[model samples]
Target chain A: MSANPVSRARLFGSAAIVITTLAALIAAVLSIGPSGLVWAGIIGAVALGYAALSFVLHLSYPDAAEAAWDEQNTVAHRDSLIFGFWAVLWVFLVFLALSLTGRMDPAMAFYWLGPVLGAVPPAHYVVSVLRGRAE
Target chain B: MTTKLIVHLRVYRAQAKLTQAELANLIGVSRKTINTIENGVFTPSTTLALTLAKALNCSVHDLFALPE
Candidate 1:
Protein backbone atom coordinates (compact mmCIF):
# COMPACT_ATOMS: atom_id res chain seq x y z
CA MET A 1 0.00 0.00 0.00
CA SER A 2 2.97 2.31 0.29
CA ALA A 3 3.68 4.46 -2.76
CA ASN A 4 6.94 2.60 -3.23
CA PRO A 5 6.48 -0.84 -1.78
CA VAL A 6 8.46 -2.79 -4.36
CA SER A 7 11.41 -3.27 -2.02
CA ARG A 8 9.17 -4.49 0.75
CA ALA A 9 7.40 -6.87 -1.57
CA ARG A 10 10.70 -8.15 -2.84
CA LEU A 11 12.06 -8.64 0.67
CA PHE A 12 8.98 -10.44 1.82
CA GLY A 13 8.91 -12.57 -1.31
CA SER A 14 12.55 -13.53 -1.02
CA ALA A 15 12.12 -14.43 2.64
CA ALA A 16 9.18 -16.62 1.83
CA ILE A 17 11.12 -18.44 -0.87
CA VAL A 18 14.18 -19.03 1.31
CA ILE A 19 12.15 -20.26 4.24
CA THR A 20 10.05 -22.55 2.12
CA THR A 21 13.03 -24.02 0.29
CA LEU A 22 14.97 -24.61 3.49
CA ALA A 23 11.98 -26.18 5.16
CA ALA A 24 11.47 -28.50 2.23
CA LEU A 25 15.12 -29.47 2.22
CA ILE A 26 14.97 -30.29 5.91
CA ALA A 27 11.80 -32.25 5.45
CA ALA A 28 13.20 -34.24 2.58
CA VAL A 29 16.37 -35.05 4.48
CA LEU A 30 14.53 -36.11 7.62
CA SER A 31 11.96 -38.17 5.79
CA ILE A 32 14.38 -39.99 3.55
CA GLY A 33 15.92 -41.99 6.46
CA PRO A 34 19.19 -41.95 4.58
CA SER A 35 22.01 -39.47 3.87
CA GLY A 36 22.19 -39.21 0.09
CA LEU A 37 21.34 -37.60 -3.27
CA VAL A 38 17.77 -38.90 -3.24
CA TRP A 39 17.02 -36.38 -0.54
CA ALA A 40 19.15 -33.87 -2.37
CA GLY A 41 17.01 -34.19 -5.48
CA ILE A 42 13.91 -33.73 -3.39
CA ILE A 43 15.43 -30.58 -1.96
CA GLY A 44 16.25 -29.37 -5.42
CA ALA A 45 12.68 -29.92 -6.58
CA VAL A 46 11.34 -27.91 -3.67
CA ALA A 47 13.77 -25.12 -4.29
CA LEU A 48 12.65 -25.06 -7.89
CA GLY A 49 9.02 -24.89 -6.82
CA TYR A 50 9.70 -22.01 -4.47
CA ALA A 51 11.61 -20.15 -7.11
CA ALA A 52 8.55 -20.34 -9.32
CA LEU A 53 6.37 -19.48 -6.34
CA SER A 54 8.32 -16.28 -5.80
CA PHE A 55 7.49 -15.16 -9.30
CA VAL A 56 3.82 -16.00 -8.88
CA LEU A 57 3.71 -14.03 -5.65
CA HIS A 58 5.26 -11.06 -7.39
CA LEU A 59 2.36 -11.08 -9.83
CA SER A 60 -0.22 -10.55 -7.08
CA TYR A 61 -0.14 -6.77 -6.79
CA PRO A 62 -3.62 -5.20 -6.43
CA ASP A 63 -3.38 -2.14 -8.55
CA ALA A 64 -5.25 -2.48 -11.81
CA ALA A 65 -4.01 0.98 -12.69
CA GLU A 66 -0.38 0.30 -11.90
CA ALA A 67 2.32 -1.90 -13.40
CA ALA A 68 4.19 -4.64 -11.55
CA TRP A 69 7.07 -2.37 -10.58
CA ASP A 70 8.08 1.26 -10.63
CA GLU A 71 10.28 2.92 -13.23
CA GLN A 72 13.45 2.13 -11.27
CA ASN A 73 12.67 -1.56 -10.95
CA THR A 74 14.55 -2.65 -14.06
CA VAL A 75 17.79 -3.01 -12.12
CA ALA A 76 16.19 -5.31 -9.60
CA HIS A 77 14.58 -7.28 -12.40
CA ARG A 78 17.89 -7.80 -14.17
CA ASP A 79 19.65 -8.81 -10.97
CA SER A 80 17.01 -11.39 -10.13
CA LEU A 81 17.27 -12.83 -13.61
CA ILE A 82 21.06 -13.00 -13.58
CA PHE A 83 21.11 -14.77 -10.25
CA GLY A 84 18.32 -17.09 -11.32
CA PHE A 85 20.09 -18.02 -14.55
CA TRP A 86 23.32 -18.85 -12.75
CA ALA A 87 21.54 -20.82 -10.08
CA VAL A 88 19.69 -22.85 -12.68
CA LEU A 89 22.82 -23.46 -14.67
CA TRP A 90 24.70 -24.50 -11.57
CA VAL A 91 21.91 -26.78 -10.43
CA PHE A 92 21.62 -28.34 -13.86
CA LEU A 93 25.33 -29.04 -14.04
CA VAL A 94 25.26 -30.53 -10.60
CA PHE A 95 22.26 -32.64 -11.46
CA LEU A 96 23.96 -33.87 -14.59
CA ALA A 97 26.98 -34.77 -12.55
CA LEU A 98 24.89 -36.59 -10.01
CA SER A 99 23.00 -38.51 -12.68
CA LEU A 100 26.24 -39.66 -14.19
CA THR A 101 27.28 -41.20 -10.86
CA GLY A 102 25.43 -44.46 -11.79
CA ARG A 103 22.34 -43.83 -9.67
CA MET A 104 20.33 -42.35 -12.56
CA ASP A 105 20.75 -42.71 -16.28
CA PRO A 106 22.37 -39.87 -18.20
CA ALA A 107 19.38 -39.55 -20.50
CA MET A 108 17.15 -38.93 -17.50
CA ALA A 109 19.08 -35.79 -16.82
CA PHE A 110 17.71 -34.25 -20.00
CA TYR A 111 14.34 -34.10 -18.33
CA TRP A 112 15.56 -31.19 -16.26
CA LEU A 113 16.50 -29.05 -19.22
CA GLY A 114 13.04 -27.51 -19.55
CA PRO A 115 12.95 -26.02 -16.09
CA VAL A 116 16.58 -24.99 -16.33
CA LEU A 117 16.01 -23.13 -19.57
CA GLY A 118 12.84 -21.60 -18.23
CA ALA A 119 14.67 -20.07 -15.27
CA VAL A 120 17.50 -18.46 -17.22
CA PRO A 121 15.50 -15.62 -18.75
CA PRO A 122 13.96 -14.61 -15.48
CA ALA A 123 17.34 -14.71 -13.78
CA HIS A 124 18.94 -12.66 -16.49
CA TYR A 125 16.06 -10.21 -16.32
CA VAL A 126 16.67 -9.83 -12.61
CA VAL A 127 20.31 -9.05 -13.22
CA SER A 128 19.42 -6.56 -15.90
CA VAL A 129 16.86 -4.94 -13.63
CA LEU A 130 19.40 -4.46 -10.86
CA ARG A 131 21.95 -3.04 -13.26
CA GLY A 132 19.42 -0.62 -14.81
CA ARG A 133 20.14 -2.39 -18.05
CA ALA A 134 16.75 -1.98 -19.62
CA GLU A 135 16.22 -2.43 -23.34
CA MET B 1 21.48 -6.17 -32.92
CA THR B 2 17.83 -5.23 -32.74
CA THR B 3 15.39 -4.40 -29.93
CA LYS B 4 11.66 -3.92 -30.04
CA LEU B 5 8.70 -4.41 -27.70
CA ILE B 6 5.63 -4.34 -29.91
CA VAL B 7 2.94 -6.79 -28.80
CA HIS B 8 2.46 -5.14 -25.38
CA LEU B 9 1.19 -6.87 -22.27
CA ARG B 10 -2.44 -6.03 -22.90
CA VAL B 11 -2.67 -7.97 -26.12
CA TYR B 12 -1.02 -11.03 -24.70
CA ARG B 13 -3.22 -11.07 -21.59
CA ALA B 14 -6.25 -10.89 -23.79
CA GLN B 15 -5.14 -14.05 -25.55
CA ALA B 16 -4.44 -15.99 -22.35
CA LYS B 17 -8.05 -16.71 -21.30
CA LEU B 18 -7.61 -14.56 -18.22
CA THR B 19 -9.32 -11.56 -16.77
CA GLN B 20 -7.03 -9.04 -15.14
CA ALA B 21 -7.79 -10.52 -11.72
CA GLU B 22 -7.18 -14.08 -12.89
CA LEU B 23 -3.87 -13.17 -14.43
CA ALA B 24 -3.00 -11.01 -11.43
CA ASN B 25 -3.51 -13.96 -9.12
CA LEU B 26 -1.36 -16.10 -11.35
CA ILE B 27 1.44 -13.52 -11.45
CA GLY B 28 1.06 -12.22 -7.86
CA VAL B 29 0.28 -8.70 -8.93
CA SER B 30 -2.77 -6.57 -8.13
CA ARG B 31 -5.68 -6.34 -10.53
CA LYS B 32 -4.99 -2.66 -10.81
CA THR B 33 -1.51 -3.38 -12.03
CA ILE B 34 -2.82 -5.85 -14.55
CA ASN B 35 -5.42 -3.42 -15.75
CA THR B 36 -2.89 -0.64 -15.96
CA ILE B 37 -0.59 -2.80 -18.00
CA GLU B 38 -3.38 -3.89 -20.33
CA ASN B 39 -4.31 -0.29 -20.85
CA GLY B 40 -0.74 0.62 -21.66
CA VAL B 41 -0.52 2.77 -18.56
CA PHE B 42 2.82 1.16 -17.70
CA THR B 43 5.45 -1.17 -19.05
CA PRO B 44 6.59 -4.27 -17.21
CA SER B 45 10.22 -4.55 -16.18
CA THR B 46 12.45 -7.43 -17.19
CA THR B 47 11.48 -9.60 -14.21
CA LEU B 48 7.81 -9.03 -14.77
CA ALA B 49 8.14 -9.57 -18.45
CA LEU B 50 9.73 -12.95 -17.85
CA THR B 51 7.13 -13.97 -15.28
CA LEU B 52 4.26 -13.02 -17.49
CA ALA B 53 5.85 -14.65 -20.46
CA LYS B 54 6.23 -17.89 -18.55
CA ALA B 55 2.69 -17.85 -17.20
CA LEU B 56 1.23 -17.10 -20.61
CA ASN B 57 3.37 -19.75 -22.27
CA CYS B 58 4.91 -17.36 -24.72
CA SER B 59 8.14 -15.55 -25.42
CA VAL B 60 8.72 -12.02 -24.13
CA HIS B 61 8.59 -10.90 -27.71
CA ASP B 62 5.14 -12.41 -28.06
CA LEU B 63 3.93 -10.31 -25.17
CA PHE B 64 5.93 -7.30 -26.30
CA ALA B 65 7.36 -6.61 -29.72
CA LEU B 66 9.66 -4.05 -31.27
CA PRO B 67 8.26 -0.92 -32.81
CA GLU B 68 7.86 -1.00 -36.58
Candidate 2:
Protein backbone atom coordinates (compact mmCIF):
# COMPACT_ATOMS: atom_id res chain seq x y z
CA MET A 1 0.00 0.00 0.00
CA SER A 2 1.10 3.52 -0.72
CA ALA A 3 2.14 5.67 2.24
CA ASN A 4 -0.38 8.19 3.50
CA PRO A 5 1.00 11.70 3.33
CA VAL A 6 -0.84 12.86 6.41
CA SER A 7 0.48 9.98 8.49
CA ARG A 8 3.94 10.70 7.13
CA ALA A 9 3.60 14.31 8.18
CA ARG A 10 2.48 13.33 11.64
CA LEU A 11 5.43 10.98 11.96
CA PHE A 12 7.82 13.67 10.83
CA GLY A 13 6.35 16.22 13.21
CA SER A 14 6.48 13.84 16.14
CA ALA A 15 10.06 12.90 15.33
CA ALA A 16 11.13 16.51 15.13
CA ILE A 17 9.51 17.29 18.47
CA VAL A 18 11.04 14.31 20.22
CA ILE A 19 14.52 14.78 18.79
CA THR A 20 14.58 18.46 19.61
CA THR A 21 13.32 17.90 23.11
CA LEU A 22 15.92 15.22 23.78
CA ALA A 23 18.70 17.34 22.38
CA ALA A 24 17.67 20.30 24.44
CA LEU A 25 17.45 18.20 27.56
CA ILE A 26 20.87 16.69 27.02
CA ALA A 27 22.35 20.09 26.40
CA ALA A 28 20.74 21.50 29.50
CA VAL A 29 21.97 18.62 31.64
CA LEU A 30 25.54 18.70 30.31
CA SER A 31 25.88 22.49 30.61
CA ILE A 32 24.46 22.75 34.11
CA GLY A 33 26.74 25.63 35.12
CA PRO A 34 25.97 29.33 34.84
CA SER A 35 24.55 28.75 31.35
CA GLY A 36 22.06 26.13 32.57
CA LEU A 37 19.16 28.55 32.89
CA VAL A 38 19.79 29.90 29.42
CA TRP A 39 19.77 26.36 28.00
CA ALA A 40 16.54 25.70 29.86
CA GLY A 41 14.91 28.73 28.30
CA ILE A 42 16.05 27.69 24.84
CA ILE A 43 14.60 24.24 25.40
CA GLY A 44 11.29 25.72 26.51
CA ALA A 45 11.10 28.01 23.50
CA VAL A 46 12.03 25.29 21.07
CA ALA A 47 9.42 22.97 22.55
CA LEU A 48 6.77 25.67 22.41
CA GLY A 49 7.57 26.49 18.79
CA TYR A 50 7.45 22.82 17.80
CA ALA A 51 4.09 22.44 19.50
CA ALA A 52 2.71 25.54 17.74
CA LEU A 53 3.89 24.34 14.37
CA SER A 54 2.16 21.03 14.86
CA PHE A 55 -1.04 22.79 15.84
CA VAL A 56 -0.84 25.00 12.78
CA LEU A 57 -0.31 22.01 10.53
CA HIS A 58 -3.38 20.39 11.97
CA LEU A 59 -5.36 23.58 11.38
CA SER A 60 -4.18 23.74 7.80
CA TYR A 61 -5.35 20.20 7.01
CA PRO A 62 -9.06 20.15 7.66
CA ASP A 63 -9.49 16.68 6.28
CA ALA A 64 -6.50 15.57 8.31
CA ALA A 65 -7.62 17.34 11.44
CA GLU A 66 -9.72 15.65 14.06
CA ALA A 67 -13.32 16.55 14.70
CA ALA A 68 -12.12 16.88 18.26
CA TRP A 69 -8.38 16.57 18.66
CA ASP A 70 -8.55 15.73 22.36
CA GLU A 71 -11.24 13.13 21.83
CA GLN A 72 -9.33 11.46 19.04
CA ASN A 73 -6.18 11.49 21.14
CA THR A 74 -7.85 10.02 24.19
CA VAL A 75 -7.08 6.38 23.53
CA ALA A 76 -3.50 6.88 22.51
CA HIS A 77 -2.97 9.27 25.36
CA ARG A 78 -4.48 6.79 27.77
CA ASP A 79 -2.24 4.03 26.51
CA SER A 80 0.80 6.23 26.73
CA LEU A 81 -0.09 7.23 30.25
CA ILE A 82 -0.54 3.66 31.32
CA PHE A 83 2.73 2.64 29.73
CA GLY A 84 4.51 5.56 31.32
CA PHE A 85 3.10 4.78 34.73
CA TRP A 86 4.28 1.21 34.50
CA ALA A 87 7.67 2.26 33.25
CA VAL A 88 8.14 4.72 36.09
CA LEU A 89 6.96 2.16 38.58
CA TRP A 90 9.47 -0.31 37.26
CA VAL A 91 12.28 2.21 37.55
CA PHE A 92 11.20 3.06 41.06
CA LEU A 93 11.18 -0.59 42.00
CA VAL A 94 14.67 -1.05 40.65
CA PHE A 95 15.85 2.00 42.51
CA LEU A 96 14.27 0.74 45.71
CA ALA A 97 15.87 -2.64 45.33
CA LEU A 98 19.25 -1.10 44.72
CA SER A 99 18.94 1.15 47.72
CA LEU A 100 17.96 -1.70 49.99
CA THR A 101 21.01 -3.60 48.85
CA GLY A 102 23.18 -0.53 49.48
CA ARG A 103 24.19 -0.53 45.84
CA MET A 104 22.56 2.81 45.12
CA ASP A 105 22.14 6.13 46.86
CA PRO A 106 18.51 6.66 47.76
CA ALA A 107 18.89 10.40 47.26
CA MET A 108 20.05 9.83 43.71
CA ALA A 109 17.17 7.56 42.75
CA PHE A 110 14.92 10.36 41.59
CA TYR A 111 17.69 12.28 39.87
CA TRP A 112 17.11 10.33 36.66
CA LEU A 113 13.38 9.93 37.16
CA GLY A 114 12.54 13.09 35.25
CA PRO A 115 14.34 11.93 32.15
CA VAL A 116 12.77 8.50 32.47
CA LEU A 117 9.33 10.07 32.58
CA GLY A 118 10.13 12.18 29.55
CA ALA A 119 11.24 9.12 27.59
CA VAL A 120 8.18 7.00 28.29
CA PRO A 121 5.50 8.32 25.93
CA PRO A 122 7.80 8.57 22.94
CA ALA A 123 9.17 5.11 23.67
CA HIS A 124 5.65 3.76 23.93
CA TYR A 125 4.69 5.39 20.64
CA VAL A 126 7.68 3.96 18.82
CA VAL A 127 7.14 0.48 20.22
CA SER A 128 3.45 0.56 19.43
CA VAL A 129 4.12 1.57 15.84
CA LEU A 130 6.76 -1.09 15.43
CA ARG A 131 4.48 -3.77 16.82
CA GLY A 132 1.49 -2.52 14.82
CA ARG A 133 -0.35 -2.07 18.11
CA ALA A 134 -0.95 1.63 17.57
CA GLU A 135 -4.45 3.11 17.58
CA MET B 1 -4.81 -11.03 23.25
CA THR B 2 -5.92 -10.48 19.71
CA THR B 3 -9.53 -9.47 19.21
CA LYS B 4 -12.09 -11.77 17.61
CA LEU B 5 -12.88 -9.13 14.98
CA ILE B 6 -12.60 -9.84 11.24
CA VAL B 7 -12.19 -6.83 9.01
CA HIS B 8 -13.37 -6.38 5.44
CA LEU B 9 -12.44 -2.70 5.37
CA ARG B 10 -9.92 -2.85 2.57
CA VAL B 11 -12.34 -4.55 0.20
CA TYR B 12 -15.09 -2.06 0.82
CA ARG B 13 -12.64 0.84 0.62
CA ALA B 14 -11.41 -0.47 -2.73
CA GLN B 15 -14.96 -0.83 -3.99
CA ALA B 16 -15.66 2.74 -2.96
CA LYS B 17 -12.45 3.90 -4.65
CA LEU B 18 -11.10 5.39 -1.47
CA THR B 19 -7.55 5.29 -0.23
CA GLN B 20 -6.78 4.68 3.42
CA ALA B 21 -6.08 8.36 3.96
CA GLU B 22 -9.36 9.36 2.28
CA LEU B 23 -11.35 6.95 4.41
CA ALA B 24 -9.52 8.09 7.53
CA ASN B 25 -10.28 11.75 6.68
CA LEU B 26 -13.93 10.88 6.12
CA ILE B 27 -14.12 9.22 9.51
CA GLY B 28 -12.08 11.89 11.32
CA VAL B 29 -9.29 9.53 12.33
CA SER B 30 -5.61 9.21 11.50
CA ARG B 31 -4.65 7.20 8.46
CA LYS B 32 -2.57 4.98 10.76
CA THR B 33 -5.71 4.05 12.66
CA ILE B 34 -7.49 3.13 9.45
CA ASN B 35 -4.48 1.22 8.17
CA THR B 36 -4.15 -0.76 11.39
CA ILE B 37 -7.87 -1.57 11.42
CA GLU B 38 -7.82 -2.58 7.77
CA ASN B 39 -4.84 -4.86 8.32
CA GLY B 40 -6.47 -6.39 11.42
CA VAL B 41 -3.51 -5.20 13.46
CA PHE B 42 -5.77 -3.23 15.75
CA THR B 43 -9.39 -3.50 16.77
CA PRO B 44 -11.36 -0.30 16.53
CA SER B 45 -13.70 0.83 19.26
CA THR B 46 -17.43 0.48 18.60
CA THR B 47 -17.79 4.21 18.02
CA LEU B 48 -15.04 4.23 15.43
CA ALA B 49 -16.38 1.09 13.78
CA LEU B 50 -19.78 2.71 13.49
CA THR B 51 -18.32 5.95 12.18
CA LEU B 52 -16.36 4.02 9.56
CA ALA B 53 -19.45 2.09 8.63
CA LYS B 54 -21.45 5.28 8.24
CA ALA B 55 -18.73 6.82 6.11
CA LEU B 56 -18.65 3.78 3.80
CA ASN B 57 -22.43 3.70 3.55
CA CYS B 58 -22.68 0.36 5.29
CA SER B 59 -23.58 -1.12 8.63
CA VAL B 60 -20.92 -2.00 11.17
CA HIS B 61 -21.80 -5.63 10.72
CA ASP B 62 -21.12 -5.31 7.01
CA LEU B 63 -17.58 -4.14 7.58
CA PHE B 64 -16.80 -6.37 10.57
CA ALA B 65 -17.81 -9.87 11.54
CA LEU B 66 -16.90 -12.71 13.87
CA PRO B 67 -15.39 -15.88 12.55
CA GLU B 68 -17.93 -18.62 11.91
Candidate 3:
Protein backbone atom coordinates (compact mmCIF):
# COMPACT_ATOMS: atom_id res chain seq x y z
CA MET A 1 0.00 0.00 0.00
CA SER A 2 1.17 3.49 -0.72
CA ALA A 3 1.98 5.14 2.57
CA ASN A 4 -0.68 7.51 3.79
CA PRO A 5 0.22 10.33 6.19
CA VAL A 6 1.01 8.71 9.53
CA SER A 7 1.90 12.00 11.16
CA ARG A 8 -1.68 13.18 11.40
CA ALA A 9 -2.60 10.59 13.95
CA ARG A 10 0.52 11.31 15.94
CA LEU A 11 -0.35 14.98 15.75
CA PHE A 12 -3.87 14.36 16.97
CA GLY A 13 -2.78 12.12 19.84
CA SER A 14 -0.14 14.45 21.21
CA ALA A 15 -2.34 17.49 20.79
CA ALA A 16 -5.07 15.79 22.69
CA ILE A 17 -2.71 14.91 25.53
CA VAL A 18 -1.20 18.37 25.81
CA ILE A 19 -4.58 20.01 25.73
CA THR A 20 -6.03 17.71 28.32
CA THR A 21 -3.04 18.10 30.60
CA LEU A 22 -3.21 21.88 30.34
CA ALA A 23 -6.89 21.87 31.09
CA ALA A 24 -6.27 19.72 34.10
CA LEU A 25 -3.69 22.17 35.36
CA ILE A 26 -5.95 25.15 34.79
CA ALA A 27 -8.84 23.53 36.53
CA ALA A 28 -6.66 22.55 39.45
CA VAL A 29 -5.34 26.09 39.72
CA LEU A 30 -8.72 27.79 39.65
CA SER A 31 -10.50 25.40 41.92
CA ILE A 32 -8.36 23.25 44.19
CA GLY A 33 -5.70 25.64 45.37
CA PRO A 34 -2.92 25.46 42.82
CA SER A 35 -1.29 22.43 44.42
CA GLY A 36 -2.91 19.96 42.09
CA LEU A 37 -2.42 22.25 39.15
CA VAL A 38 1.19 22.62 40.13
CA TRP A 39 1.58 18.89 40.04
CA ALA A 40 -0.28 18.78 36.80
CA GLY A 41 2.11 21.38 35.47
CA ILE A 42 4.96 19.09 36.50
CA ILE A 43 3.39 16.27 34.53
CA GLY A 44 2.88 18.53 31.54
CA ALA A 45 6.50 19.50 31.75
CA VAL A 46 7.49 15.87 31.77
CA ALA A 47 5.25 15.04 28.87
CA LEU A 48 6.65 17.96 26.88
CA GLY A 49 10.17 16.83 27.60
CA TYR A 50 9.39 13.36 26.34
CA ALA A 51 7.74 14.87 23.29
CA ALA A 52 10.85 16.85 22.45
CA LEU A 53 13.09 13.86 22.97
CA SER A 54 10.87 11.76 20.78
CA PHE A 55 11.17 14.35 18.05
CA VAL A 56 14.94 14.29 18.19
CA LEU A 57 14.97 10.51 18.24
CA HIS A 58 12.75 10.35 15.19
CA LEU A 59 14.94 12.78 13.31
CA SER A 60 18.12 10.94 14.16
CA TYR A 61 16.83 7.44 13.77
CA PRO A 62 13.82 7.95 11.49
CA ASP A 63 13.14 4.27 11.37
CA ALA A 64 13.42 3.67 15.09
CA ALA A 65 9.99 2.55 16.19
CA GLU A 66 10.04 3.78 19.79
CA ALA A 67 11.34 6.87 18.16
CA ALA A 68 7.77 6.96 17.06
CA TRP A 69 6.95 9.27 19.89
CA ASP A 70 3.67 10.76 20.98
CA GLU A 71 4.06 14.11 19.21
CA GLN A 72 7.44 13.83 17.65
CA ASN A 73 7.13 13.08 13.96
CA THR A 74 8.31 16.09 11.93
CA VAL A 75 5.12 16.90 10.05
CA ALA A 76 2.83 15.61 12.74
CA HIS A 77 4.51 17.61 15.52
CA ARG A 78 3.48 20.91 14.00
CA ASP A 79 -0.03 19.76 13.43
CA SER A 80 -0.32 18.54 16.99
CA LEU A 81 0.97 21.78 18.49
CA ILE A 82 -1.33 23.90 16.35
CA PHE A 83 -4.35 21.66 16.53
CA GLY A 84 -3.73 20.90 20.18
CA PHE A 85 -4.61 24.47 21.03
CA TRP A 86 -7.80 24.30 19.04
CA ALA A 87 -8.84 20.93 20.43
CA VAL A 88 -8.29 22.14 23.98
CA LEU A 89 -10.40 25.19 23.31
CA TRP A 90 -13.12 22.99 22.00
CA VAL A 91 -12.80 20.82 25.07
CA PHE A 92 -12.79 23.87 27.29
CA LEU A 93 -15.98 25.13 25.77
CA VAL A 94 -17.51 21.73 26.29
CA PHE A 95 -16.42 21.66 29.91
CA LEU A 96 -17.66 25.19 30.37
CA ALA A 97 -21.07 24.24 29.12
CA LEU A 98 -21.11 21.23 31.33
CA SER A 99 -20.13 23.27 34.32
CA LEU A 100 -22.85 25.82 33.67
CA THR A 101 -25.41 23.11 33.29
CA GLY A 102 -24.16 21.42 36.43
CA ARG A 103 -24.35 18.17 34.54
CA MET A 104 -20.96 16.68 35.38
CA ASP A 105 -18.05 16.85 37.77
CA PRO A 106 -15.46 19.45 36.88
CA ALA A 107 -12.79 16.84 37.44
CA MET A 108 -13.95 15.44 34.14
CA ALA A 109 -11.25 17.81 33.02
CA PHE A 110 -8.74 14.99 32.53
CA TYR A 111 -7.98 13.75 29.03
CA TRP A 112 -10.78 11.26 28.58
CA LEU A 113 -10.87 10.52 24.90
CA GLY A 114 -7.14 10.10 24.54
CA PRO A 115 -7.05 6.83 26.39
CA VAL A 116 -10.42 5.61 25.24
CA LEU A 117 -9.17 5.93 21.71
CA GLY A 118 -7.62 2.57 22.57
CA ALA A 119 -10.28 1.62 20.07
CA VAL A 120 -7.45 1.57 17.57
CA PRO A 121 -5.92 -1.84 18.05
CA PRO A 122 -2.50 -1.89 19.74
CA ALA A 123 -1.56 -4.95 17.69
CA HIS A 124 -1.12 -2.91 14.55
CA TYR A 125 1.04 -0.35 16.29
CA VAL A 126 3.25 -3.19 17.42
CA VAL A 127 3.39 -4.50 13.91
CA SER A 128 4.38 -1.12 12.57
CA VAL A 129 7.15 -0.91 15.14
CA LEU A 130 8.59 -4.26 14.19
CA ARG A 131 8.16 -3.69 10.50
CA GLY A 132 9.80 -0.26 10.47
CA ARG A 133 6.76 1.13 8.75
CA ALA A 134 4.64 4.04 9.89
CA GLU A 135 1.46 1.99 10.20
CA MET B 1 19.18 9.14 9.55
CA THR B 2 20.40 5.91 8.10
CA THR B 3 18.34 3.50 6.07
CA LYS B 4 16.97 0.74 8.27
CA LEU B 5 15.96 -2.89 7.95
CA ILE B 6 12.30 -3.66 7.46
CA VAL B 7 10.01 -6.67 7.72
CA HIS B 8 9.09 -8.92 4.86
CA LEU B 9 5.53 -8.29 3.65
CA ARG B 10 4.39 -11.77 4.56
CA VAL B 11 5.93 -11.71 8.04
CA TYR B 12 4.18 -8.56 9.22
CA ARG B 13 0.75 -9.63 8.00
CA ALA B 14 1.08 -12.98 9.67
CA GLN B 15 2.26 -11.46 12.92
CA ALA B 16 -0.77 -9.22 13.10
CA LYS B 17 -2.85 -12.36 12.56
CA LEU B 18 -4.61 -10.38 9.93
CA THR B 19 -5.59 -11.33 6.47
CA GLN B 20 -5.16 -8.31 4.24
CA ALA B 21 -8.92 -8.11 3.94
CA GLU B 22 -9.62 -8.17 7.67
CA LEU B 23 -7.17 -5.38 8.44
CA ALA B 24 -8.49 -3.21 5.64
CA ASN B 25 -12.06 -3.65 6.80
CA LEU B 26 -11.18 -2.73 10.36
CA ILE B 27 -9.33 0.40 9.28
CA GLY B 28 -12.10 1.44 6.93
CA VAL B 29 -9.66 1.15 4.12
CA SER B 30 -9.58 -1.17 1.15
CA ARG B 31 -7.80 -4.51 1.06
CA LYS B 32 -5.52 -3.08 -1.57
CA THR B 33 -4.08 -0.83 1.10
CA ILE B 34 -3.24 -3.79 3.26
CA ASN B 35 -1.79 -5.62 0.33
CA THR B 36 0.37 -2.67 -0.54
CA ILE B 37 1.58 -2.35 3.03
CA GLU B 38 2.35 -6.02 3.05
CA ASN B 39 4.31 -5.72 -0.18
CA GLY B 40 6.55 -2.87 1.02
CA VAL B 41 4.96 -0.64 -1.59
CA PHE B 42 2.92 1.25 1.00
CA THR B 43 3.53 3.07 4.24
CA PRO B 44 0.60 3.71 6.53
CA SER B 45 -0.42 7.00 8.11
CA THR B 46 0.04 7.83 11.78
CA THR B 47 -3.69 7.49 12.32
CA LEU B 48 -3.64 4.11 10.67
CA ALA B 49 -0.64 3.11 12.75
CA LEU B 50 -2.43 3.88 15.98
CA THR B 51 -5.48 1.98 14.79
CA LEU B 52 -3.37 -1.00 13.89
CA ALA B 53 -1.30 -0.83 17.02
CA LYS B 54 -4.40 -0.65 19.15
CA ALA B 55 -5.76 -3.75 17.52
CA LEU B 56 -2.46 -5.56 17.87
CA ASN B 57 -2.15 -4.96 21.59
CA CYS B 58 1.41 -3.67 21.50
CA SER B 59 3.45 -0.53 21.13
CA VAL B 60 4.19 0.80 17.65
CA HIS B 61 7.75 -0.21 18.47
CA ASP B 62 6.76 -3.84 18.59
CA LEU B 63 5.22 -3.60 15.14
CA PHE B 64 7.87 -1.52 13.41
CA ALA B 65 11.60 -2.05 13.88
CA LEU B 66 14.91 -0.41 13.09
CA PRO B 67 17.95 -2.05 11.51
CA GLU B 68 20.58 -3.33 13.90
Candidate 2 residue runs with Cα over 4 Å from true position: A1-49, A55-63, A67-74, B1-3
TM-score of each model, in listed order = 0.36, 0.71, 0.30
Quick one: RMSD of model 3? 14.8
Instruction: Provide fnat values for all models in the order shown.
Output: 0.07, 0.37, 0.00
Candidate that would win on DockQ: 2
Q: How many Å off is the CA of A65 in candidate 1?
A: 8.2
lDDT of each: 0.56, 0.67, 0.50
lDDT tens digits by residue: candidate 3, B8-39: 54565578788876666555554545555556
Compose the digit string of candidate 1's lDDT tens values, residues B1-68. Answer: 64534546766778877887688768766555555556554567788788889999898877776676
User: What ranking of all candidate models by lDDT puts the best one first?
Assistant: 2, 1, 3
Spell out the clash pairs found in candidate 2.
Answer: none
Q: TM-score (chain B) for model 1?
A: 0.79
lDDT of 2 by residue, B10-66 (tens): 998998999987887677776667777888766777888888888889999999999
Native contact fraction (fnat) of model 1: 0.07
Predictions ranked by TM-score, top down? 2, 1, 3
Off by over 4 Å in 3: A1-34, A62-90, A101-135, B1-36, B39-68
Lowest lDDT 10-mer window, candidate 3 chain A?
A: A115-124
Give the TM-score (vs. native) of candidate 1: 0.36
Is model 1 an incorrect, acceptable, medium or high docking prediction?
A: incorrect
